[model samples]
Target: MKKIALIFSLAVLLVLGLSTAALAATNGPHGGFTTNTASCAQCHKTHTAQSSHLILFALVSGSQNDIYRTCTYCHSSTGSSHYDEVDGEIKDGSNLWATSAGGFQSMPTVEGATSYTTMATVSSKHNADQANNTLVAIPGGSSALKFELRCDSCHDPHGTQNARQLVPTVTVWNTLGTAYNTVSTIPNGAISMTVNNPTTNETITYNDDHINDFCGACHTDYLQTAVNSGSTQSGTYTSGLYRHRVGMAAAGASGYNAAYFALPTSSPAGDVLCVTCHYAHGTTAAVSSTTYANGSTLLRMDERGVCQDCHRKTFSTSQPAVVAASSYQVSATDKNHVVLAFNSYMEKVSAQTAGNYTVTGTGVTGVSSAQLQPNGVLGKTVLLTLNGSLTTGSSYTITVNTTTVKDLNGLAVSSTGNTFTFSSK
Candidate 1:
């Protein structure tokens, strides 16, 4: 009888062990994770086949239309919806989820409509025929390029904890500047996860939270350090002046003083975050076709599109000249036109002897003859130009103990005066 009882207990133990192993195997690698879908099903019942694939509790039905059906599930024009909570504007009864319905209908669907393909309009900026053009293979025949935009291209239905359900570790803004107070969009450097296949005994790594890395996968230029890395900056990339701060922090982050956005030293967060300009889903702001409105070179709204959100003055299309001048060093303070030319003949007329000119201004009481070629302009301006009998490639020097010259504004020279040696180029 005792032996029979021991055998029964052993059988029970074996059955339980096998059951636990089977359960573990069923879970595979990404086990013990409850997805957001469970939470989404609270208000929605999956009675039909189509509803089973959707988050029924979504704010609206998914079978409505291409634009409305999918978006309205979580977003709404009124009530306590995600769209309303995010300060999204509602047009007519529906919010501008993807494109402006009214504006889209107003324009002719065919070629006779307006040429610009605004976000609010039905026109598409991309040339569909060109999308399938030949792919140029890289050196050594590694891979070919192709383009497509499916529903998954811009969204992750998994529901991210971050606003807009964004992928992890992305930077939306990089530096804080006169126009904005944020750093370049940089991804969080750390944070990782993994997936495993029980049957194959294989594991795959995933980084769900690194912001910049995720956005860089699509917006390639934002990932580039050198301009030539892609099409956005290519020939236009320049240090300190022309480049946009996409992935770097302002200059003062590490006590370095370069040309970068300024940030408060006390702010605990150090780098720019990516969600700054781009909505992980979409936006209703109208952009230009050639620049940001249609699409940027990197398929972004455009540099001006991003800039205009914070700087309205810089993106006015009607005033092209006004907008262009403000984007560069063409401001009133920039002295591009303040020039000075050395009149060698006038110097000779004023000089008592050749190779020397008289000094008549304040702090210019030198009794000796002036070095006409170089001494006529001694630190009088930030930059100087010499024009006269001084041939190109001629070397000269200016010596001044304490002399002051007037600028076009008639202001006395206030900067330190040092001997500058240079040959006309």
Candidate 2:
């Protein structure tokens, strides 16, 4: 009887031990280390250690702006094992580069320069003392007061149940779903935390879809789905169709090429969340087949690789129907029929310089007129009207070359297979 009683007691203790471990693992992502008060303190100290931040006073390869060099110290500069670069090779991990697609600045923010308010790149001379990035206002601030663009702006070092440790209020998108944006419920509840000694598993459970809202907290203007018109071709902003599609639904829907594209596991219900497309810190240097810089975009692959993952088609336009005939002989129907089915992505049309289009044909006579769709946005296709008609059972060839037409990164349209034939009837 005594032996049986002792065995039962030991079994109960074992079960309790296992239960405690399971609970701890559920709360703490870093090897069961509770992400409570000290979550951020682990990285920073009250004394503000200079070693924590990398200061550049004429160092090695190239100069970095004050923003990138500072925060990347932990994850980038020191060759730390946690470095975010692809091959662990550093090429400056700042998010601001040439393409400020959804940036708040009227002009681009540059590095290697002291001030970002005016210049587009970073100035090496501008230290923390010279200019405060927070002095200038971001898109969405609760107080309407200006703040610096720092890591604290988006994250809470102390750690929270929120994904990526983002502040709570930030979970709500500032844009309020103005036009075509995702509308999802935000969670507001206290969660548990756990801590275990000597562990490296720091994963957070992101249950809700608030990444877009988090990005929108500062880039409010990015939520706008409106086209921009300007005088200079480069000056115009017209990617309204699907530029930085934040709140837009991504649940395998029509707006996106759902036929081929699949949503990431992170994106719930198929919303193209911010984190879905961009990395929190910058990415390692990488180039795409189209000769565009995909590293900066932080796309899953690189450059336009994000879009090309599902949309794999060549650039070609075809005439559905040749103009039959007309009294003036200049067939408006034929001209409209010669539409270019842009299998490839297009940059804004205004960027399309004049005298860049070259249309020629053998069977078709008098190629009267041609024009791009949407006037200047990154339209999916170009409408070309022809002045000639196709005869019964007659085959003809027409070629198109918008040599100046390019993707967002300025890679010109493929100059091959611009030809099309009318095969029957």
Q: Which one is best on TM-score?
A: 2
Candidate 1 per-residue lDDT, tens place, 108-162, comes to 1111011212123323221111221222221111122222322223333444443
In model 2, the Cα lDDT at residue 385 comes to 45
Which 10-residue window in model 2 sums to the lowest lDDT? Answer: 121-130
lDDT of 2 by residue, 1-425 (tens): 32353354345335323333432332222222454633333333455444323232222232433443443433222322222221212112221122211121122212211123322221111122223332444423333434344444454444566424555443322232222222222234222222222122122233445555455545553443223312212211223333434444554333345433422424234545555555443432135436642224443223554555334445234412122221111122222234444544355552233334433444455455544332222233444444455454555555545455555434555556445555323
Q: If scored against the real structure, what TM-score would every candidate get?
A: 0.32, 0.36
Model 2, stretches more than 4 Å misplaced?
Answer: 1-73, 77-146, 169-207, 224-268, 283-425
Candidate 2: RMSD to truth: 21.4
